[model samples]
Target: MPPRPRPRPRVAVVVFPGSNCEQDVAYALNWLGLDSAYVWHGDHSLDGFGAVVLPGGFSYGDYLRCGAIARFSPIMDAVTRFARAGRPVLGICNGFQILAEAHLLPGALLRNAGLKFICRDVALRVEARCDWLDAPTGSVLHLPINHNEGNFVCDSATLDDLRADDRVIVRYCDEEGRTDGVSAPNGALDNIAGITNAARNVFGLMPHPERAVDPTVGGSDGQLVFQSLLQQFTQEVF
Candidate 1:
């Protein structure tokens, strides 16, 4: 009998000093029955994983900036290479900020509009089609967000370019669940919550989809994102 074949779409979740979601992310992937492992920041090696995820947390205690220091870790050296190679890379929350700092994408993450740390579950709408999931065009999602710097900003030209490229993903909506397609004075532009880089392989978002993998948690929309990626991985495994 031939080898069953190693898991396709293998993923590595980078674990930094203060990463609070490493295990949760690993668990989410495991629940989806996809092969995933936690990679150390100083490892400098990805072991040939097909995807990489930078989970949420105050890495280096949010010193300097959320993901600023983690970007210099040995593993990021490999991350830089993997991302540039067009492999799938997902960054959530602080991970988003780090990606921007690494120049893997445009824009910077700033403090929330109210200048206060926020920790609560929120809803997001998928505004753009993406390979991240078979997410329906107008799907609404709910997940937790805990951050002091979740604001997204970029120059006008760059913002226009990203818009032209269809890089924007999720966005925040109003009480009636309506959105104007612009970030409110609340930090995000067009209420943007997530986006992918130019290569369409690197993705980053400010919400915690992994936290909503189960319906008992009061929201199941988060599951689709992981499900879509897992399906993609399963297809690639063959």
Candidate 2:
């Protein structure tokens, strides 16, 4: 008999009306050899996919709240279910707001400390031993961040719980990858830029790694994140 065909990993990138990075995310995934596609906000089925990504954009125009209206969309119901199964779920920028709004993740993203919409390249340090990156303990990943509401805040007790649970992902840092009192654009707690749900399957962040996939664009630091996740899922399913 012919060798068994390796199963292709799949990703569902949720598309809200204002989502601008869906294609960028898809391109990145496809380039990385994953079977990925865009899932409309109205599509409620996640049958063929093992992973889901909520791409960055101004969902609902950041009205009322960043992801307030998006949490009520039809597809989010399915996204929640996938997350419950311990499937990988990633949310970027506005998608981070939606996840927090849905209570899939903790804390809330507030306006920047400077009270201005900031957009530029910012350095980040990976804090925990994560399946999504599997990066070395002190690895630093530099990428772009663009948002009006990128401040991450939670109560002291909750923050402590997150730390103990190891839910924190990317954190703001300087060229030296220090997470001290250096303020990037917003004053995120402990310089936090990304976090995962209690289960670690659901992740959300403010930076755009998809936007930095090419050396022609100045850096390819974000590609490791996708590779790490791909390796993680392949090890389990294959």
Candidate 3:
């Protein structure tokens, strides 16, 4: 007798009026053999989704700040509840801004120091072991970033806490994975490009990992994130 097959993990990609990356997320998840669907901003419930992703895009036309307006969407309440349940929630680029606005994560993303929209591939150094990231510490991942307001900033106390708890998951670095001031794109404070909540289930990053999942696009380094979530589910729930 063969063992029962594990259930496929279903992911929800939240879609707002102005969201443009939900399809990208869904496609990436599909490539990984996971089931995924878009949840409208008014859905009010996450139900059976095994994971939630806030993909990169100009949500709500980026009005009233990047993610400020989207934070009040009816679905955010459900997202907050889902995150509090220790489920894996990932926020990418503009999604990161929404997570911060909802207070699921700390800090804010401000205008880039250069004051221009940047779109390019960047090297990210995996710095923390978060639930959604299994890359070894110091591994370099190539992910694309496209944003005008990607500079990450937090108050001194919040920064201290994030560092003390090892919640800063990744940092913009060079190809060699050297995280120093010279590698800080958008002039992010302390060169921080990503971080997670103290619980490690809620992760946010400035780079667009979903965009890197297809080999034709660039590299599949970003697939590690989704793969890591699958690994986590197998290890802890199977």
Q: Candidate 1, TM-score vs. the true structure?
A: 0.91
**Which residue runs of candidate 2 sit more than 4 Å off their true CA positions?**
1-4
Each prediction's RMSD over C-alphas, in Å, is 2.2, 1.4, 1.2
Pull out the clashing pairs in model 3: none
Q: Distance (Å) between predicted and true CA of 43, model 3?
A: 0.5
Give the best candidate by TM-score: 3
Best by lDDT: 3
Q: Rank the candidates by lDDT, best first.
A: 3, 2, 1
lDDT of 2 at 43: 90
Q: Can you write out model 1's per-residue Cα lDDT over 75-96, one digit (the tens) per residue?
A: 9989999989887888988888
Between candidates 2 and 3, the one scoring higher on TM-score is 3
Q: Candidate 1: misplaced stretches above 4 Å?
A: 1-6, 175-177, 181-185
- Global lDDT of each model? 0.81, 0.86, 0.90
Better model by TM-score: candidate 1 vs candidate 2: 2
Clashes of 2: 0
